[model samples]
Structures are given as structure tokens and as C-alpha cells.
Target: MASGFNQKNKQCSLQELAALVPDGSSIALGGSFLHRGPFAFVRELIRQEKRGLELIKQSPGYDVDILCRAGVLRRVRAGIVAMEGNFGLAPWYRRAVERREIELEEHACASLTAGLRAAAFGVPFQPCGGLHGSSLPELNGWKCLDDPYGSGQKTWVVPAIRPDFAVIQASEVDAQGNVRVHGTAHWDRIMSRAAGSVLVVAEKVVDSAVFEAQPESTLVPYFMVQNYAVVAGGAWPGSSWPAYAIDYPAVEAYMDKNSDLRAHMAAAPEAQEGNHG
Candidate 1:
């Protein structure tokens, strides 16, 4: 149904799309630290100045960083930042956390994955051993206790995170929003199913028959997607495959030139390199 509906029938614009999410809605974003990720839509959300939106990111990117900087996000339940390779070492995100600009509930990647998976599985919560001996205990409001068997072990049981909405990008999706992903799919599958609502952006729109040809390859079914958009260069300035190239020089320029997300969001989209023709 997501594909059957057009821009007029569905919420397509970023402002209108953001309006669908009320204050205090928990959101899930799809992607790892980098590579193929969603950033354009995320930027638009921040531009609309959406408030009280809690975020759940399995592998956050500059998308998370911008939201935090714009002060639109109130709380974050994330595995790590898209930076630093280890978890999250984003310069802007780290600075905001250090300054107490936002509320944070940090967890390890495995635990974050389990949390979303639990939601997708329709479970209340999953028992996780992440953050056994780290500052996450005090920050996340989670109870970290010791073992009674004298095993000298510690564990932190993180509650499941079922999001109000999930936003993600895909290589290709049928008109009905049945998406297919290959090669380092990332947590896109879990995040899409775990949310009460799902919005997918695809580069190309194909017929449902294509998706049906390889049912197993369909990571997300149409029923789960409430809205879908065919957006080219949707993952701009970072990663887009086959269709376009990642504009890293522009991303770095945006990062260096703008101090706040507001300014960066207001700036023009980066012009692609080697377009002399």
C-alpha cells in the first residue's frame, strides 16, 4: 500500500512527514556508522524543528549528531555513533554529551540489536549483558547488579525499545514498498519491523513481481511500511550506490564550515564533483 499511494495521498514532504510524529515519539533510524545510510530525510526532520522526539539508533551517523545539535531530540537510545569505528566518537555528538545537551541511554551494539529485535519479536524486553562495568549504568537509568554465585560477573539488563517510527533508505523497493537489500544490510530489517510506523526511501521503484521473484530477499514487507518515497540522492553527501557517488569532500566541508546543525541544514546541497559538462 505504501507504493500504491502517491505523494498527494501520503505524507511525503519532510515537514508533513515530521508532523505525523507527535511530541515524545520514540524513533528508530537505520544504518551503521557510515557506508549506506539515510541522512537527507533526517536533515529535513531537524529542519522542521520537531520536538520531544526520542531516538533509537542501532548504528547512528551524522543524522543523530544533527538531531542532537538542533535540540529537536530529547532522549537517545543508541548503540554507538557513526564515528570512531569502535562505537561512537563523533566530534559534535561527543561535545554535546560532554556539555549535557541531551539525555542519553547508551548500550553496546549487541544489546542495542537485541533491544530492537525484541520489539520486532513482540517481546516486552530482552536480558542483555552489555554495559557490565561502564558508565552506561549511571547514564541509562538501568540497574546493574552483581552475580550471586560468586562468578565475579556483572550484567546490565536493558529494556526493549519499540519505536513509534522507523526511517530508512534502500537500494530498491517495489511500488508497494517491499524492500530488498544485499551486502552488509545493516540493522535495517530489525529497525523497520520494530516500529509502529515505517517510512522507506528508495532510489528506484520496481514492480511487486520483482520482489516476489526473490521473497527471501525482501527484508521488509509492504504491510509494515506506512509511507514510502522514491528519492534519488536521498543519502547525499555520504553514500549512494550505483546511481551516484558519495560526496565526502562536501560532507567534510559541511562539517568544518558549520558549527551548528541549523546552519548546515540551511546550506545548499553539495554540487557533485567533475561535472564540467
Candidate 2:
């Protein structure tokens, strides 16, 4: 049997990592819209022709949009799916949901994060005070229960969302598979622990000893990472924080190239291969 340390050191190619995710699996993607998502791994997934994936995210941008455009998603559970700031909505995702081509389970960002937290803690559900008066509970099938300790107050409880796989892109990862995220962790940290399998793709890979110098920088511990890959510009077209900026022109060009869903699906594999390369 492989030792614990050796198991944690399971580094592989992007294609090999993508192959671990079976079709129809529930997948949680790291990053909040335009930042630090495993874009290269996602591209590899598309190339490998996996389909019927259930996507979960706090706020999705290219990662979710591209997958939906390629007709790989069967359902989406997210707080929101849009290009942050001036970019507006993720066109493909909006169209798919609007056309009833894909099922959507929406929640407030905090609720989604809370659910992942619950999963990470191995709990049945997590209660939040938010969404008490909103119709989101009904729309998304979340439950509202009376607070046992409060003065007859109702609390909305979100069920745990333990996905089959969690794919994340980090600023750096050490040889032992400890991942580091420079800026915001978003929901990646919790999501990594919430998933059955975790894959970390890093902009750079360093020696395990590096973490000894600054342990606080280690965001995702090695035990939580099942597979790791070193892919430069792994989060291409999206910002990876302190390391690189979002490739706005590339993103715009991609959006323009795949504006038509039918055409994009027909040529997705070839187009994405070139894009990733």
C-alpha cells in the first residue's frame, strides 16, 4: 500500500486529473467568478468528453459558462453565475437556464458557503439567519426551521453539498500537495474538504520545505488533496491573484468565438485544446 505521504504526493497531468471525474458526477469548482478556477483542468475535461456534470459554485464565470456551453452540465447549484463588475451576466449560462436546458438550484452566497462548511464538518445541515423572509427557500427547496434557542425566530437550514470532486487552482502548491491561495479563498478551502476527491492545480509547485518557512500560507493541507498538477497559467483568462491578472482580451475573444451554442458545442474540443495550449 502507498504510504500517507506518498498518497498525498500523487501529482499527474491535467488530462489524468480530468479523467478521474466521471460523467454525471457532482463537481464543485473553486474561485469566485474570474479568479483562480481550474480552467486548464476544465478544458481538459471538455477535451475528454465528460458530460452530465452537476456544477456547484458560489459565483461562477468562465469555468461554469464554458462547461454549460459545451453541454457538459446537467444541473447547477450556485449563488450566482455572472461576470463580476462590468462584465454582466454569463451569456451562455443565462441562456441555458432561461431555456430550461439545465436545472438550477440557486441560493444566497452565504447559504452556499454555509452548506459547504457543513459538509466539511460532516454535518447534516447548517443553519443561517439569512433568507428568513425570502422565497429562496421555497424556490431552491431549502428548509426553514424555528430556532430552538431563539425567541420563536425561524432559521433557514441549507443541506450539505458534498460533491464527488472538487477542482481548484491555487497560487502555489508544495511537493507534499499543500495548496496556497494568495488573495481571497472564496469557498475553495471549504469546498476542498467537502468533496470526496480534491484536485489542486497550481501556478507553480515548490518544495515541501517551503511551508515550514511560513505555515500560515498553507491554505489546503496535503491530506485533503488527492491529486495535484503544476500547470503554468492554469487559471488563464482568469486572474490567479498575486501571481497574474485576468486575461480580459482572451476572455472576450473566447466569448466571441463561442457565441453560438450549437457551433461552440460542435467544435468545443478542438477550440478548447488550442485555447489551453
Candidate 3:
């Protein structure tokens, strides 16, 4: 956790921020399904050829699908990976798993949250009885233990999943690294705490005075943030609440199984200079 102790301006370009992700690193993505997920950053990873990444998210769609198409990800840990309704499944993700090109470890949303919470709490594991009647515990080999209080109840505990980094998309961020999220945080807060460090992708950059005036509104205090980038439309194709909504046409093109994503990749600035072939 970088405490912004020096009060340094943590801003950088999208390429600079994405470069911090190592090949084969385990990274947690903020947002759920199609909303506010960092698709722009994912594109940069593909362009940089940051291969063998393990993506962790509660729900993901376009980001994971495109990563799979680019052969950038080797494994995925998530509850469910799909395009929000009407678009149906994340076609590329399904195809990759079906072809055995990617390893998928599925979990219930609750189980995943419990695992993240445990890591954020600085604990090795957390007990959860929510997995009952679900095969996730057995499939993932989670440990089942008896309560120490003699309650005669068994609790299933999941191992902590600490990612090397957590990438979050925020509505606004100050030069000092303080972030303000206009809507639901989803699991971004927990991921920030559970991760080795946090990288924020913001839609707008405001002055430090805005934060000092209302410190309580900061969703991710500068202390938990390590680095950040300001891209006006950073969450493109995904909704950045209070600013914009999901872009349906872009999503449709992405959902089209025939698309090679070369066109889409060429459109993003960070990927334009790199060879997408």
C-alpha cells in the first residue's frame, strides 16, 4: 500500500501505468461485468505483449474476452465471465476454455468476496458457510474445518487471493492520487487493499483543492493508491457512471465472434504505435 506520504502527483500516461504489470502476473480488475471495467488498460496489455496474465475479477466480459483473443491471459479466477444480457456469453472466453487454451477456476461471487476480504484483512483464510451445496469448495480444494467454539458446525474457508496489482477505473482523481468514485465501488476497495499495489485509471483529473475541501468523498484515499493515469474516456465501451453509459455499438462489435479486434486495437492510442498483428 503506497501511502502518498510524499504527496507526490501519481499521474502517468496509460502506457506508463500498464507497463507496471509484469508478464505472468496476477492482477485484479475493478468493476463487474461490463461496467467501469478497465478495457482500455487491457488493450494496452495486449499491445505490450504482456503475456501469461492471470485475471481476477468477480465478473468480467469484454476485457477478458479481448485478452483471450490476443493470447495475453493464461488463467482466469472469477465468479462468472459474460457480457451483460442481450450480448450473451463472452464468446472468446468460452472458446478459449473449450479449446483448453485457458485454465478457468470458477467461484461463487460470495466465495470470491470472502477470499478477497480475507486478504484485505491481512489473514491467511476466511471461514464461509455460503458454499454449501455448491461444488466450488471441492473443485477449488478449499479447506473445511470445525468451529473452535464447539458449535459443532463446519465452515469452509477459502485461501487468500492476493494479486500483484489491482487496476481501478475512477470517475475523478486528483493530482495527489486521491480518487473519487461517483457510484457503486463494487469490489474495487477490497481489491485495492488485497493487492500488492493499486493503479487507478481515471476519466477526469481535478485539482488537489477539490479533495481538501471534501476529504470524506474520496473513495480511494491517496494512501492506498500507488499510481494513476488520466484518460478522458478511460472506461470507454464501459460505463463510467455520472459521466457516461455503456457504449452498445462498441460492445456489439466486440461481441461479434468474427471480429479479429485488429480494428478496435488500432483505434486506441496506446495500441496504435505497437504492432497488433
Candidate 4:
């Protein structure tokens, strides 16, 4: 957890942020598909060589794939894992699952969101509809319950999915840890609330006055952030909209040369966000 709920000034280096998640943690990643991911923070986690971690995300692309390549993940709970059109698939993630090197517990997009909502709302479970005619409900151990008011309709109840941490990418976060995310927060609010703690990887760390002047822009409040790091272009090779777009060439090159990650990363400085606080 964070130092304290009331503790201010959560800014730290990427390494310090990564240190908070120990081995065997079940971590929820922010962003959807390839946009606005905490790639820089993910890189630090790999560099630190954290092992036996469980990844939880509704949709993941580069983050899950790289972790699979690094042998950092033991299990994954996600609805979809793939690189978009620029790249057809997350090859390393596919290979790992095919090789039975790790475990996967899949969910539909709605089901996963229900689970997060359950945890965030401090409920035992949340009722989910639209999962009919699918095996995922049974496969995921979601219980079936009859509608209470004698309506006789049945729904799936997803047990609370409380991850150890939620790591998010932000457009900006102030020294006090108030976060601002410009485009496509993409279930980040629910993910943050559902997790035990939150870590933010930000494009810039600004002054608290910036947030005070525009409180409505604060997507994540100060108390919710355990720690954060300032990394310009933190989401590289993936888009952090209004700032940059997906680096498809870099991504394709990564798929080809990932076996030599050190060499590949040397050519893409934004992948590691440089070694600065």
C-alpha cells in the first residue's frame, strides 16, 4: 500500500514504483488495447526481474506480450490479448500459452468489468448479464443466481476480483499525486478502485496548482495514488493520444528482435523512459 492515505508528494523514480509490487503479485494494468499503457513502468518491472506475477487486464497488447517474453508472468486474467492491425498478434504471449508455460483465466469484457466493479463497490459479487450461451461463466466459476424479487431471471455473479495493484499511465500527475488523463481513461477509474493500491506512470509531474486550477481534469485523486514516476513519452510504441501515435515500425521491429531485448531497447529510448527520477 501507499505510505499513507494522507501522505502527499508520491512522486518517485520508476524503480521505486516497481519495488512496491513484490513477486507473486496479482497486478491490474491500465489502458485498453495498445493505448496509454504504462510501458515504462512495465519495463522497470521486467528489469527488476519480478517473477510469478499474475496479470489482470480487460484487454492487453504490448504489456502482456513483453511480460510473457521476460518470463515475468505466471498467470494472466484478461478478455483479449493481441496487438492491433499494425501487428496481428501478441506473438510471445501466444507462444507462452501454447507452450503451457503459464495459466490463463479468460473473461468477457463485461464480465471482467463486473468483477472490478464488485470489488470497487465493496460487494461480495456483482450480477452480470449477456454471458448466456458461453462457457466462460462456468469456466471462470461465476455462480448463477436467480433474480431475487421472484422475477425468475438468472444472472451470473462474478466474485470480487481484487488485484494487488493497478498501474496506470497518466497525461500528467502533480507532486501531490493528482492524476490527469486526457484521452480514453478506459476503465482505469474502476481498475484503480478495485486494486489494493495504485501506481501511476506519467508523461510529466507538474505542480499541485495545476490540478487545483482544474480539478475536473483530475481523473485520479491524490489519496488513491500510492506512487508515480515522471517519464516523458512513457507509453512508447503505443499511442498516448494528443502527444503521439503508435510506433508501428518500432513494434514490428520488437516482434522480430525481442530475443535480444537489451539491444532492441537501446534503439528505443522511450521504451525505458530513460533512467531519471
On lDDT, the candidate that comes out on top is 4
- Runs off by more than 4 Å, candidate 2: 1-9, 257-277
Best by TM-score: 4
Ranking 2 against 4 by lDDT, winner:
4
Badly placed stretches (over 4 Å) of model 4 are: 1-8, 257-259, 270-275
Q: Per-residue alpha-carbon lDDT of model 4 for 145-247, expressed as tens digits?
A: 9988899989888989999999999998877788899877998999999999999989887777778788888888988888988888778878898889988
lDDT (Cα) of model 1: 0.69
Error of 1 at 29 (Å): 0.5
lDDT score at residue 60, model 4, on the 0-100 scale = 94
lDDT of each: 0.69, 0.81, 0.84, 0.86
Write the residue-wise lDDT of candidate 3 on 1-277 in tens digits. 2333466667878888899998999999998887888878888898789999999998888888889988999999998888888698888899899999989989887788888889999999988767888889889999999989999999999999899999998988887788888889988989998999999988878877888788888888887888998776667788889788888887888677676588977665345443221
**How many pairs of residues collide in model 3?**
0
Q: To one decimal, what is the Cα RMSD in angstroms of model 2 from the true structure? A: 3.6
- Kindly indicate the candidate among 3 and 4 with the higher lDDT: 4
Q: Point out the worst 10-residue segment of candidate 2 by lDDT.
A: 268-277
Q: Which stretches of candidate 3 lie over 4 Å from their true place?
A: 1-6, 269-277
Q: Candidate 2 clash total? A: 0
Q: Report the Cα RMSD per candidate.
A: 5.1, 3.6, 3.2, 2.9
Local lDDT at 69 for model 3:
88
What is candidate 1's CA lDDT for residue 131? 60
Q: What ranges in model 1 sit over 4 Å off? A: 1-15, 84-88, 129-156, 257-277
User: What are the per-model numbers of colliding residue pairs?
Assistant: 3, 0, 0, 0
Cα miss at 216, model 2 (Å)? 2.0
The residue-by-residue lDDT of candidate 1 on 53-171, one tens digit each, is 88888778677777776777878888767653433356666666788877878877878877788788888666676465677657767665577789987666666778999887788
TM-score of 3: 0.93
TM-score of each: 0.81, 0.89, 0.93, 0.94
